[model samples]
Target: MSVESIDAHQHFWDPSRGDYGWLTPELGGLYREFGPDDLKPLREAENVSRTVVVQAAQTVDETRYLLDLARNDSSIAGVVGWVPLDAPNAADLIDELAREPKFKAVRPMLQDLPDDRWIENPALAPAIHALIKNNLAFDALIFPRHVASLKIFAKRFPDLRIVIDHGAKPQIKDGGAGWQIWADGMAELAALPQGLRCKLSGLATEAAPGWTTAILKPYVDHLLKQFGPDRLMWGSDWPVLNLNGDYAQWHDAARQLTSHLNAPQQQALFGDTAKTFYRL
Candidate 1:
């Protein structure tokens, strides 16, 4: 079966807006501005017709900005915006954001937080439950250190739709040490009867100086075995991907990496699963 491809994860930000505080000068090539116009041609050249823009800043205005961008750009299918989960009115904020049809999910910057157990904070319960009540997905944008917490979070809210972004961001540069721990945590989340999905993106950024499809394939293969095609999706992770690679390069590499799969399976990995998961 043929599928219209959707780039499940990418970001757009304007430094002039002062929202992306993390996009510091140290980021070099990625510190500059990136927007839909910059990404449109690259994605179009690769035949990726649509994309979901994830939030790059923790500010709620950044989410509002993305929703506005999606409102004007048809190629932008949906957004995974940020919300202050610990706020007393987080559920109210989620309900307000849910009114926008393009606001498909929420991603708290878990990797940056000092506390690994931040998700487990009782204060976050309302926001997490609001996600389920609003029918919005939760994009787990975390590193391997936080994977164990994710297993606990999933168990506590089994019915909430969750997708592990960047294969839980394993450390691949040094032969992926502590991989067993990541695998064990991922297995725990996948074991949830409510189901979970993983994205096959951001490995190149994680691997950095030593990045290669061959080095990344084992990790992708592991997720394939754990979640299957029906629960896995692909993402470009865009301009951030430019730190190590470009959109076209990652797109081509991802296609070649998953080339072993049959047509139906490939369709799901490249497009269908994201479309279904994000309701694109």
Candidate 2:
């Protein structure tokens, strides 16, 4: 009944490689340099046997770099790399990336942008279509206001698998507590048939510093109700999570959330959901 764990949303970046512009000194110690070697200790400490390396920079090179890292390191089970959705040859790029078994999905960072923009822009539709055709999933990383866009995008591409990262990134710290907007949007997205999953990750970062499970419970509870354990997955968000807590703390928090669930349910939340959705 003991379930093996997988950290579904960790990030590794080499500042010397000149990519992560957001890691500033004000954010504290962990941002200096994060790589596979640095994450090994955390993995051991948390009993996490597998991980998914998510893209931090807005480049395909990051994806290729993670795939190469995965080739050398067995711990990284998958890579959620980014690609320019508006690019003309995005379809071809996805086709090529799919050839690598470790490349599981694509993520375009949509949270930083404005709310009115369409994810299914005419130019991006072909690329999205290619993702569906190639069996690659798309990670919907958006803010609360943009959550409603998923409804439009999901309706446009019924065959594509979509994962809402960081529980649609609610503004929990800002006291956006009512959550009517995010909760309604999540419900609409989950109703889609193709496949919709949500990551129980990054909540600590979104909440006030020193926030505890009690503070995060409302958002986590909402996701559990909307997606259920079957559609929910766990992720550490690693170095970013270091902003609020260490890897062990975040892993333990997830474990505490699943403490009441049966072993099979725990397995699905900890690893199986990600494995099945991302084909890891």
Candidate 3:
């Protein structure tokens, strides 16, 4: 299979594995096993040629499990697994993980951590350096409040290819609550010299129930204005997307929202940009 329309940020997890601390029965339909098999047909329906499976659990074992899955599933073009950046031997772990052919990036679950400024810690320099040395991307999974510190981190490590996951997960669920803050923060990051990128995923989950493409258009439009299609990439956010919508629904909504872009620009958002950012 070749890379064309890539789902740049989706995930798979087995609650039975007991690794995903955040997964619980309360999440309803999302509290079950979701693998490539479950998403394969849906992605095929939408012409998603390949996918980048991301981490759901914050454990290295889970990261290894995801890589093992990718090793066997050719459709999985990349894996954004996790490593404890605050650990003493984080550099060693990163070195070991980077040796895997499918490990394209490392996400530290920054959103779940209580410390919004965790990524700005100086203690993480060695691990981050190892990431730069290994030529891997950094997935910043954060909320609106963490944007300031992330900017500082981006400034300090200009060489680290940083990607803001879910557009820093804007507060879209509450009618774009704090719109100015999210907008200004995203614009600031986009203007930075580091060339920080962002994923066009997980917005459905962040949106209000019964949300439509119209509700997401403003946020997506803002992203295009800031990062442009060359720096933005599309993703499904899949099973979690079930929280608000489903796979095909979100894909359709994304297509509808971006329908106005010309062929080249649309291609960049759906595939080319991710291909370049993740070096797929």
Candidate 3: the clashing residue pairs are none
- Against the true structure, candidate 1 reaches a TM-score of 0.97
Q: Which candidate has the highest lDDT of all?
A: 3
Evaluated at residue 166, the lDDT of candidate 2 is 92
Candidate 3 segments exceeding 4 Å error: 1-3
Which sequence of candidate numbers ranks them by lDDT, best first?
3, 1, 2
State the local distance difference test value for candidate 1.
Answer: 0.90
- Ranking the candidates on TM-score from highest down gives 3, 1, 2
lDDT, model 1, position 50:
95
Expressed as tens digits, the lDDT of each residue in 1-280 for candidate 1 is 3459999999999888897868888988888888999998999999999999999999999999999999999999999999999999999999999999999999998998899989888788989999999999999988878877887888899889999899888888768788898888778777888899989889888885747788888888888889998899999999889888888888998999889999999999999999999988
Backbone clash total, candidate 1: 0
* TM-score-better candidate, 1 vs 3: 3
Candidate 2 local lDDT, residue 5: 82
TM-scores for all candidates: the values are 0.97, 0.95, 0.97
Model 2 TM-score (2 dp): 0.95
CA lDDT of every candidate: 0.90, 0.84, 0.91
Better of 2 and 3 by TM-score: 3
